[model samples]
Target: MLIRDLPYADPGVPDVRSGRHFLLWLGRRQLRGQAKSLAWGTLHMASVASIPIAVGLAVQAVVDRSGGGLALAGALLALLGLGATVGDTMLHRTAVTNWITAAARVQQLLARRTAELGATLTQRVAAGEVVAVSTGDIEKIGWCVESVSRFSAALVVALSVCVGLVVYEPELGLLVAAGLLLLIAVVLPLLPRATRRADLQREKAGRATELAADTVAGLRVLRGIGGEELFLRRYRSASQEVRQAAVRTARMWALIEAVQVALPGLLLIAVVWHGTGLAMDGRITVGELTTVYGAVTFLLFPLRLVQEFAMAYSFSRPSAARAARVLGLRRSGDGAGVGDGAGGGEARSLENPAEGDLHDPAGGLLAPAGRLTAVVCGDPDEAGRLAARLGGHDPSAEEDPAEEEGERPDARERALPSVLLGGVPLDAVPLEKARAAVLVQDKDPVLLSGTLRELLDVPGSGRVSANEALAAAQCADVLDALAQGTPGLNGDPLEARITERGRSLSGGQRQRLALARSLVTDPPVLVLDEPTSAVDSHTEARIAGALRRVRAGRTTVVLASSPLLLDCADQVVLLQDGRVTAAGTHRGLLRDDPHYRAVVTRETDDELAEGTTHA
Candidate 1:
């Protein structure tokens, strides 16, 4: 696998058993690249090891006054230099390829998982954690992957050099071997402590990152409520905790580095001391003593390689574990035998499946095809849960059975039934198909940063035009507000840029823009939860009227208790105790059902009296 071929030609299903298993899976996926890296790394290290022998030969030639040997040594040195250059270049190239390819594979997996989970992703994992995994964690994992080949090559070169030394001078070779073994024994015991510290540091850093993200996301709200100082203090505390943890982790790693350096220096001293005795005893020549000293000095390079690989692996293990946790998350009822219809098997093979009515059996509500239906729930939470179900989302579907039994009964738990489309369970439909068939706009919809034109440009664009949707959403004031701030925009809202999360716009402006974006998609079924809650009563009335007119022949389910929106619906279903207790025209329900009237007419008496006084 090369960088160009990445994101993996096929990022095959991962073995998400554990973090260690996931790392192994990555290695298997790029076996060929790893092999190439190993081969080049071996060549590089071998040439590096050969340099000491060349230098020793040159020295001996000069001492013996042999011109032919000197020339031969020079020629050999040149060849080794050329080999080292080629090997080093290719080694670097292959290592980088491995790093990039591994990171790309992980990125692709994460992107796919995010798409599959959609809005529920943040519910299961922190947004900051996801961000951390995609950025820092990915780099650590790639670093480990890149180091593996180099480490293996270093081990091979180290062993080959040791064997050659043993054959050249048995007495000095035994001493060198014992010193190497002692170094390994001393360093190996310290690794677990270092790994533990690294884990602690990473945990603290993730919490700090999460706090920072949350603070930034709600900065506007914090300023509005005079709570900026409180959040700022909280973030500062988190940052300090992260700093302390990082310092502790750094200290442990520094100890390991000290050992790596100090142990090798000791080994080099032992070889030099012992080699001098062998040369004096006439058991080894001067050239042989030089070679022994040079080889031990060169051995430090491989020892450092081993230390680097250990450090990289320690950091990457936790990162891989985090990635695996995300990859292992499956949506509720995903691949379960519960709702197995359009989302699986032969039904998924269909190119253009027909559209149908949406039904919520548990709620005892039916949103007929091509009709505007409104749902009014006494409890806002119940209403939100019902809206999510209408879009084929059930949080309980993926919950553990034991934990599900332990929770107190709520609206969702009381009636845990799947929503259906045309008698087929909605969850049974493929997510893409279900998303295309039904568009659900939550109470707090997100508006991505982009030009108005770009925001409105959605997939499948024939059913509704951007202008029509904007008008229906009553975005004229929003457009005017945005245009007033920028003169070069030519008073065209479509050309104006919205800040991240539409932060530059007011709450009402952002809400309307989100509605317009949703309306532009023109899905067969549109389920909206409090779509006009942020607007004033008059503006809400306009939106209610416009929505009725624009969605005349499409299935629209609006979960709101607002009288204006409810009155505009052809049918109003009053949801109470997690079931549809009353269903009729809004006026009919107001006249006959006291409970329904009370729920919809929630305005204070002072407000009603004030309105009458104005009239």
Candidate 2:
């Protein structure tokens, strides 16, 4: 497919058998492009090889004093030069297309997998490794995939030229073939050392990248706790380690390059010496000597291509393996199947339940549609996991090897958790539909850089307008905060541009802004975790009041123990030790269930001092 037709509608399932297999799969996917590149590369190298041959023919004609033959040779040389130029241009164009398209395909696949696995991917794979795959590894893979055709062409033309020389004059031709073989022998042995060095460099670089990402992400926290210098020093040490590794890699490659150049020079000398001897001994003509010398010199171009192929393959193999490992990762439901539900058959046909209740069979909790439900749990982590499951994350999902090539993904008894929506398992629901049906706002939601309007713009039900969402989220002052920091945007608060991750906004402001954005989406089911923890109690109370009014008669699941939020819910459920312990109105739970009150209010000292008694 052309570059414009990218982001392949399917991106197809990847082959995760091994790193080498994954790379081979990538090449096979872009067959048409590779074919075009190979054709162009063949034309280019063949045309280049013809140039020296034409010059040698002209030299022979001139020596024989044949004016007609000399004139014919001149025209042939010009034609060969033009062909070389055009072929090289087209070859480069096709190769670049192959590179970009391959990279794009991998990037799209990664994005799709990311959405499928969601937050759990970060839990299974190191953040640094993921970054390296997306950044450095992607380029390496693309480079290797695109280089294959060119290297093939080089090998073909190199062999053809050698065969021609051998047939024309056995003496000089055999000498040239032997010299080429010797060059290959010497270069092949140095590759393993270079490969090891390259792998070391990539490892160190990945560690450094991870360190830098961590330091930057925590810069705000580091500065607050006076730990900025400590991290900076640590990063410096990591950076130096990476530098040393890189230098070692460069040294190995340099030695290889030196050998490459030195061997080719010696080969050219040997061919000239042998051809001169043959010409003087009446075994070859002066013109034949010219041709043999020219061919040997030109053969170096293809030999260098071989070296390039070797280096590219060594570096890309590990990268492909890493990408394969990531692609192979499947949700725990694919194998663990802890809570089976109809073999995930219902996932594809799911839609907004409209009035269906959300049921958690394992916990025996059912949240009726069109009601505000608050979930309280003693552990924040447990609450977070519940929220994730509620948002269609397979509770039993864990990363494992994806099905091998030629294996149907459907063959696996992929059983999702029995967390059902309208009797259909949430995990079984197709991700696109699941995302649309349920909205989960995490405790630490990230705000990407953009205008306020752009941030709020999402594929929403459109039932809740921007201003209404902002009001319900208690984000009135957030507009003022944006205006004060940004210039010339006071006229329209929506136009105010926020910096990366909303760095300019305070924790409370960022939280409210994210909450407002979430509200604007107006999904069929809304699930929030600690939505107002960063805000003051007063602001939290305002949000509670507006939240109930704006989201009236809608399915809202608030996973928090905040008294204000719980009191505002139509029904409150106490989730203890990963099970439903109590379910009732917030006030009823506080008055009747001592355990519920202990979790909601943290069992404060005043209650203990009074020695509050409960039946």
Candidate 3:
């Protein structure tokens, strides 16, 4: 089976298997590429094998020291030189191809998996592990692919040289073979220890990456709270731990390297000593002994290849296991069976969280056409979770049925409750389909680096003009800001260069820009998670009114506690604790619900305090 298929296979059994399984996983992936390169590798090996035979013949000729022998030796040496040069060149080229292709495939698989998991991936796996899998682990896997054929070809060539020597002079041949075996036995024991050290080193490095990532993400907050020094100290400590683990790892590898050099040199010494004694004993001719010596010397190179293969495998094992773990992750809510349904029309009637009807978790509504809806949640995390669910950024319905049935909906799901679209469950629909039908503009949406026009190009099935979308989003000011760009025909207002995540823009400008981008998609269902949270009250009020007007007939869910946004909603849903506490118009909620007043009025109080502080 394919390596890609192996990851999806039932790892039904425990992972007590030796590290060989990891190699098998990588080998399965490398099989096709290796097969393509194997022919060139075989030819290269043939050329390499010829070198030792030619050298032995030349040595025999030199010992004979006749005119004809000298002439033949010259030809042999010339042929050996040509073979070595050609073989080395071909070997390098083929090996590099094998490396690049294997790495590309792994990268593609990883990218595909990330797209499949979407936002839910971070919840399932640590960010550092993912980084390790994509970068360092991928390079190691590539090295394994590039090294495989060379190792095999070298082994065969080395064995061939040994056999030729045995035929030329058995006594010396036997002595050299013994030395080679001793080298193998000594180095083989180091593999396990070296691999364990490598694994620990990689794990510590991953933790350090995680700590650094956390620090970078919260740098603003850390600086704000005067905890920058504390986080810096923590990061330094993490880095030190990684440094110590690396040093230990290097020590083990250094021992292996010492053996690689020393054992081979010792073997070469023993072979020469034993061969000289045979020559002196008259049991072997000087010419024959010389041939034996040349063969043993040539054979040492391939022996080193074997040692390298062992080292490479030892280093790559941990990376492969980490990659395996990442691929093994399955979403918690993926459904067991395939969902067969065409999308359109009113969304399934979901549990109205604001209507005091805690709708069944199993049920969902296909969203209706053109209506403003409000989602209320006390906890921000709960609101975000609900937003993710509604956007279909979760998992597929085709995942294992038993896995889906085994787990119950947690409090987070019940508390934040998804707003569905159509008969098809939003959570079960694939990301591509779900995203087209519904878009969730997160509280802090990332505005990638690009010109304003380029950034406004949202992925969608329908044609929506950028200007109309921006106008609908009440972003005329953003267009004016971008007017600083060179004028274009038809008067394009989207030429403004947005810095990474739009950091160049103020908080309000960024929010309006993000909202404008979301509006461009014009998805049938738009879920805005506190879109106006960062804007001033006046801009927030204007945006709220514009959004309702622009999305007049479209299904829209706004998750907010803002009085302005709530007042503009056609219907309001208030969630308390984890259930729907009340549902009605914004004014009705203000009159009937104390919790609604407390939240919205408290926000107003905070605004007044901010004004006082400024004064």
Candidate 4:
């Protein structure tokens, strides 16, 4: 089949379709690059069938004592031998190519899908499942495809041999045909159970893989909390469960294999016994009897093919199902989507979309440029939740009052996100325009492994050098912690590679590094969750000044409890529950707002300890 036909051949087209059919659909997709290989593979099986036919003719000629017939038979035998060598070599080469290409395509599809999903994919699927699909599932899917071509060609050769045996001696031919049919059709009914068992085993293995990944990621936390042994025991139990499932699957497969090998041998014996009786009765010539024997001997190869197809499918069905399940994860907008704010609701200025002031109907508040704003909250979770909402991750509870209450709710309709740039509703503008105007740096910002220069080279960061961003985040001390340009050191710290999660750096170092990267962006609107939680008060104070200098003329929001950070803000808003309770300068709240002081100061710690003691 051609490559274009592959995508249209949906294995998921019908519920009634078997695993083998799904496998065939997958095979059709892979056959595009390996068409020539498949053609050569077919020729090899056809060439093998020629040997049995040539032997049968040669036998009849020798029995008749014909000299010319003997010469022709020898020539045919030589031709058969030549075909065998060529076919085998070409078959091996093609099969290997198909295997590698199928694997590569699956890998490419997964990577493309991941890129398309971006940050949203991580929120929905586990990291370990993605890891498992790329590494293990891809190989299994490839094996299933490559085996189809090999088995198809062999099956044709087997049928051709059976027809030849029937032509040479009709009565013995009938016996061979019936036996072969039984071998293929009757034995296959047992496979569904085998496949089901294999599916269970693979699922258990995937769970084990996920657990192992979790343990590795939380290894430090587990140890610090004295729960390492607890987690280790849990992982050990999970591993044992996987092992038990695998063993059960193995037992079922082994039983099927035993039947596969034994049944074919039994059929051969029965055919031989019946054919000999025919020869004695003069219903078949002695040479004809010999031809039937040769045919069955050759048919052994295809007989094995039929059995292996069943076995290969038993192993591959689970893997295919898993891949399908992963691909089936719906995109965010595919359901009742939070309005992407791309094209709906009221149109407004794209450059400085207003943040409709905390769901206040008195129009959105424009963030004044080059100023620091403090946001206080009673519920830390609620505050964090609002931050995520503001960042345009998912829908926030804050809704727009401009839209009529009776407007039809479309699952795809996302309320325009209420973020403002210089008093403009960020969602009122196009997403691309909004992103350019406002940037929210979340708590625990991820630091990808890269050089310091690479990290600071964000778009719109201006011509400000890496050193400047580092200076802004007060990261000079952090840079010193690294062994930069030291002789006998394996690498420069400025160029030193961090691990995937930046595990090599201290918490403060990572936080500062993340902060510096954000500073390098220099977007008009900067919202930082907590920039100096890791550093001591002295370092925090220095960072506050550095931040003020770097962010002058930029609208920056610092959602922090540190007085040092709040002391630098131009204004502070105290939010109780979900609504704004008070708005004033940092010092104004320290004196006039007892609730603010109780929530923000060290007395908050004493109160928490007292509450814990009472509990």
**What is residue 343's positional error in candidate 2, in angstroms?**
14
Model 3 lDDT at residue 283:
77
| Error of model 2, residue 185, in angstroms | 2.9
lDDT of 2: 0.82
Q: Would you estimate the TM-scores of all the predictions?
A: 0.88, 0.87, 0.80, 0.75
Instruction: Judging by TM-score against the true structure, name the best candidate.
Output: 1
After superposition, the stretches of candidate 2 with alpha carbons farther than 4 Å from their true spots are: 4-10, 114-131, 325-352, 362-365, 395-418, 489-492, 574-577, 581-615
Top model by lDDT, which number?
1
How much is the lDDT of residue 520 in candidate 4? 82
Ranked by lDDT, top first: 1, 2, 3, 4
Task: For residues 59-105, write the lDDT of model 4, one tens digit per residue.
Answer: 88888998788789889888877887887897787787777766666
Question: Candidate 1 vs candidate 3: which has greater TM-score?
Answer: 1
In candidate 1, what are the lDDT values of residues 1-615, reduced to their tens digit? 666655565677877656788899999988998999999999999998998899889888988999999999999999989988999999999999999999999999999888877776675678888888899999999999999999999999999999988887788888888888898898899989999888888878878888888788889999999999999899899889889988988898899889888988888887888778878888788888888888888899998999889889989988887787777655433534423453453354323223466788887998888888999997888887787778877755443323321332232343366787766666656677778777888887888877889899897547779999999999998888777765699666799777788888888889999999888998878899999888999999999999988887888999999889998998999999888899999999888776687688875667656755654
The digit string of per-residue lDDT tens for model 2 on 1-615 reads 778887789888888777789999999998988889888888889988887778878998989998988998999998988888888898898899989989998999888888787765665577777888898999999999889989999999999999988898787788888877887788788899899888777777878888888788879999999999999999999999989988988888888889889988988887888778878988888888887788888888998888888888888877887787777766433322312344453433254474678888777777889899999989998887787778767534443444333333431255345577777766655566677788888888889998999999888877899989988888878888888877888599899888999988888999999889888988778889889988999999999989988788778899888898988999999998889999999999898887888888788766744545524
Prediction RMSDs, each to the true structure: 5.5, 4.5, 7.3, 7.6
Instruction: Report how far residue 479 has shifted in candidate 2, in Å.
Output: 2.8
